[model samples]
Target chain A: MNILVLVKQVPDSEALVQVKGEGSGVEVEDRYTLNFFDSLAVEEALQIKEQTGAGTVTVLSLGGQKAIEALRTAIAMGAAEAVLLEDPAFENGDEYATAKALAAAAKGMEWDMILCGKEAFDDSSGIVGPLLAEFLGIPLVTTVVKLDFISEEQAVVVEREIEGGKEVIKAPLPVLLSAQKGLNEPRVASVMGVMKAMQTEIKKLDLAAVGLSQSEVGKAGSKEEILRYHRPPERPPVTMIQGEATEVVRQVVALLKDEAKIL
Target chain B: MAGDVWVFAEYQAGKIRKTSLEVLSKGRELAEQLGSGLGVLLLGSGVDGLAQELTAYADTVYYGDNPLLEKYNNDVYYQIIAALAEKEKPHILLAGATFLARDLFPRLAGRLKTGIAVDCLSLEMGDDGSLIARRPLFGGKVLADVVCREGRPQIALVRPNTFSLPDVQSPAQGKVLPLDVTVDTSQVKLEVLDVTRMAKERLDLTEAEIIVTGGRGMKGAENFQLLDDLADVLGATVGATRGVVDNGWRTHDDQVGKSGKTVSPKLYFAVGLSGAIHHVMGMNTSKVVVAINKDPQAPIFQYADYGVLGDLFEIVPLLTETLKKEI
Candidate 1:
């Protein structure tokens, strides 16, 4: 089996986001890292590679120069190789265009299994996995939290923390799966792995190589556009409660009844 | 062939949740504004007996009975809803942004190639009979006004606990429409192997009237037991901040933040969480919020409706005991 994992570099969850230029789109300030969820995807791919021990794990990412670092991180996590679909042209693609570009790259690779995080943290659209599956004409099982190889061609699965409970699915191989966090505890980068990751080769593909042009990438490539962005008003000041527990409960109840009016 | 607006009345354990009814009430108002009829689409394994409960708010109710759909699956429910949408051609579709709706509705939207405004805190009717929806973006940091510009049958996922469930008890007088939906069970490869809910005894966090969340101040994993006790006494769900989940004190499912679930309970008790903007974004919709922490300068205080300055360990247990006695 040839497994391909799609990874995206995003602002760290802890990093503060600023909407630059008085608009809806946001840019990370200070520092950024790989999306929290993608790390778990890379980890899941590595585990499958380890258990299978025969298939090759190739990391595929679509971004600019920053994506090389993300691909290197994936290599350090145990991917056999890394491919970066980067060009100035591919910047700022919407979910549809991004999924199209990714599907093209994935199709060329002839991967048996493709894995991605449920969504990109920055955009938070959560549409790419299923969208790419649509483009690729493959079955998709999203929000996947657990997976076991049922056969060489099929896998039994359970989905992530859904509303009421988990959904157990049996998906055939050569299908698309969007992973969720806790799918696997990501393995830490070993010193040897990190050193090798720095030396690993990153194959870069431009928009033209991926059968696209400048018009097919970035904002121009997007079907939906953000209209505006505004910070919500700050909540009102809180009333502090002091003294003994009994007195506090009395105050809380009275406050809930009188002030908030929920009681 | 024509209807006003439709709310998918989702029932669990044979009782309708407030979230669904809130959608129904909202749908009624929207339908009235459109000068059309309000309706509901009900489908489950054995939910025929509960169709009467749904008719209280809708002018008509459509129930599609399928044993395969008794358990929710993307394929089964979507086929049923998509078939209904194609036949009914309602001007609007609304469902609570509960887990069921979020999972099933989006796929249905994709199948029908329609736009969906998710997690909307409010929905309004425009003068032209279009639905104007207000939904949270960037994980509740900002609210956005959205409209489905493409045309009829705009869908919106109503945020849970944002609106009141009406108490009007008119008999279920609505007409019933049956849909013919074929279930291709083979495509639905997913199954519910086992089901476990954290707050099984207490109210679900998404449906809870009162939610008390803990953070790093709970001290350790064991310390959350206190918050659990408080939630038990209050019949509430125990929520936690990203910090608590990151610290390995609890599962990510229990975390309430931009990365976690967005909940708007009536009363929120925040214990120990410093209230980062991300965490506050999730619970800020709560009608009443109470914070407890030793640090007076914690950011959570800014959004908290009430604050208590002290160690949560000492205060929570006492509060739990006091509330227990009172109840």
Candidate 2:
């Protein structure tokens, strides 16, 4: 059995992001980390490989040099191999174009399952996984919180988080699942795993190698163009209520009805 | 196709979702501005009655009533919607950014070879006659304006509650057209075994009038009972930051943040939680924010409309008791 995991490098969740100039673009802080949800995908894939006792895990990422960091992090978590899809033409690609590039890279690969983060932190667009599944012509279940293989390499049962509840879905093997938080607690990489990750050679693939032309990847192939970027307008000032807890409570109850008027 | 603006009227259990109605209301304005007709694509089983309700906001209603589409099967819905878009060729297609639409729209976009802007906060027409979608990015630190420049039938998923519902002037003078589309069940690779409805009586965070959220400061899973008590008295929904959800104190459905659901409740309470930007992005649009924390410098206080520097364990119960007595 084999599993493929998709990883993305993003600024730490706590990092400060600012819009550059009027509406040109954004200037994210230099600090970068593995997207929080992608770590869960790597952890789940590793656990599946361990439970099956005989499966290889390959982690793939799409970005510049920083994306290699995310792949290495997945390697430190026990993935056997890593692939980085990078090229100048892949820049400015939207969710659809990104999924197309990933699908092209995964075509004909030997794998029984594919996993990805429910959404990327930077863009917050949770569209890639489903779009990738469509591009690869496979079934996909998003926001998966619990997953268990029913028949080793045949099928798996997953619990997907929905609006008001969860849906228990069963799909055949070779399906794509997007990992949500609470699936598992990802383990920190040990010294030995970190050393192994440092030594692992990351394979690089471009659009041409993935059988995609310049017109089929990146900004050229993207459906949406970013017109501008700007900061959200400042909100109204907060009114702080100071004093004893009971006093504050009484004042707030009054304010809720008198000022905000919701009560 | 280029002269019509389309909205996907999502329905369930013989009723239309509020977000779908919100989209239709916004789509009506866009259609009027562009001098085009407003059309709604209603898909489900026995949805002919619900389709009539949409006539108040749409100039034409396209009803696709079939048993196969009763439940949202991703593969089946994608095929049906994509085929409809191909045949009708609407200028823009709009849908609410619900879980079902979030999963369905991207695949539909891929199949139609179009671009989609998801969870957009605002939508407008560009000077060049393109669709402009403004959405929060980088955890709400920046708002990016996006446009589908080259795609036909530009698709957008607007966040719920972002737009107000237009008043129904009168029963719209529109025609309901029945769509004929065939779906092959064999192509579906995933099967729904069962759906377990948890928190059936609780309000959904996105649609709630008031929300009480806890964070890592709430301590343990059992401590959430305090939030529940307060929520009950206020008739509000309970939400958690990603930190609390990751700590296993709450399910993802109750999470409010960038990775979680964005809510615009009239009143929001941030108890025992530091205001992280990711968490703030989810509820910053809330009408009134009230924060209660021991730490006066908690980031949540900055975005909150009312700040109470105290222990939530003490203040929450007191507030709940007071509200229970007063209201």
Candidate 3:
């Protein structure tokens, strides 16, 4: 089995985001890290490879030099190889363009399964995996919390999260699954793994190599344009109650009854 | 190509979802402003009866009743919706940013080569007659106004609980148009084996009128019983912070945070939660918030309407008991 994992580099979730003045755009911070959900995707791939014992895990990312760090991080976590889709033409692309480019590059690879994070933290557009599956002409199951290869080479059963519960789905081989949180705990990179990752040569591909022209993969291909960004208005100031636990509880009950009137 | 504003009326188990009604209400406003008709695309098995309910807000109801669409098959729904958009040429398309819509709309946008703004908090018409969608990004740290600059159908997924339903004035004399489309079964490669509701069967946090959430300070899974007691008394739902969910104390569906489900209930209780921004992002839109924690410095207090600095194990029970008596 050959498993391919799609990875993305994003700002650490804890990092503060600063919007540029007049909504020109968001300022790019230097504190870049592997997107939290994607790390879970890498771990799932590694575990699948370990269980199969005959497959290689390949990590693929689309970005600039910063994204290589994400790929290396995945490599250090036990992925066998890394591929970076890098090119100037890929800049300022929307989720559709991004998925198109990813599908283009993936069409050349031979793999049984493709995995990605349920959504990227930056855009919060959980579009790519499904869109990629559509572009690749494969089946996709998003928000997968549990995955098991029922037939090894032919089919996989997955538990996907839904509104109030979960759905048990089965898809044939050559399917795409987007990893949601709680799928599995990601393993920490070992010292040996890190050393091995440093020596591994990361492969880079551009628009031409991915079989797409400049106009089909970047801003020209994007259908949406960002007009501006602004900080959401702040909520009203909180009214604090200070006292012993019982006293505070009594005060809260009184306030709810008299002030808010929800009681 | 500018035409009617269309809303995808999502339904499950033969009833239309509340979020779809909310979108219809909002779409009616936009359609009136644009001097265009408000239409609803209702698709399901034997859904003609339910399609009539949409007449309160829509001017045209497009009903596509098919057994193949009884359950949502992403490919089939995408194909039908995309085909409708191609022929009808809607100016604006809206759906609730639901699990179903989130899974379907993006694929449709890709197939149609259009832009989509997901989880939008608000929508309006831009000066150039384009749809302006304001969406929260960076985990609610900033709101970005987005537009489908040159796309014919501006697609948007409206966040649930963000808009109120308009009052029913009179039964609208709307036209019911049957959607003629085909489903290619060979295109669908995935099969649904089964769907099981979570064991707890509690109210979903997103739609709950009141939510009481615990954090790591709750200690363990067993300690959540205190929150359950409070929620039962208040007729509320129970939720957890990401830390508690990460600790395996609760299901991910119970998590209230950026990565979890965003909820805006009428009232919220942050019990024993330290108030991380990730958790706050999900509940900050709540109408009234009350925080209870041992530490006075818990960040959640900043977003709460009322705060009680105390031990939740003590305060929660006391509050529940007092509320029980008061009610």
| Best model number under DockQ | 2
What residue runs in model 2 are displaced by over 4 Å at the alpha carbon? A244-247, A261-263, B12-14, B216-226, B246-248, B321-327
Candidate 3 Cα errors over 4 Å, as ranges: A244-247, A250-263, B199-202, B325-327
lDDT by residue for model 3 over B1-327, one digit each (tens)? 248899999875566777888898899899989999888998888888887877767888898888777777676788898888998899999998888888888878877778899989899898778999999888777889989976778899988878887666485667788887597778878888887766553557876788999999999999999999988888899999999987999988899987898887889999888999778878877888999888988888888889887778778888889888888
Comparing only chain B with the true structure, the TM-scores of all models are 0.93, 0.91, 0.93
Residue B277 local lDDT, model 1: 76
RMSD of 3: 2.2
Instruction: Evaluate all candidate structures by whole-model CA lDDT and list the values in order.
Output: 0.75, 0.87, 0.86
lDDT of 1: 0.75
TM-score of each: 0.87, 0.94, 0.94
Give one digit per residue, the lDDT tens place, for model 2 in A1-263: 69999999998877788888887978888889898889999999999888888889999999998899999998988899999999999998988888889999999477889999988888889888888988998988888999999764499999888788778888998899998876888889988899999999999998788998999889888888898998887877878898888899999999989988879
Mark the 10 consecutive residues where model 3 chain B has the least summed lDDT: B195-204
DockQ, each predicted model = 0.37, 0.71, 0.70
Find the candidate with the highest lDDT and give its number: 2
Error of 1 at A206 (Å): 5.5
CA-only RMSD, every prediction: 3.4, 2.3, 2.2
Candidate 1 versus truth, CA RMSD in Å, comes to 3.4
iRMS per model, in Å, is: 3.1, 1.8, 1.8
Can you rank all candidates by DockQ, best first?
2, 3, 1
Candidate 3 chain A, run of 10 with poorest lDDT: A21-30
The 10-residue segment with the lowest total lDDT in model 1 chain A = A221-230
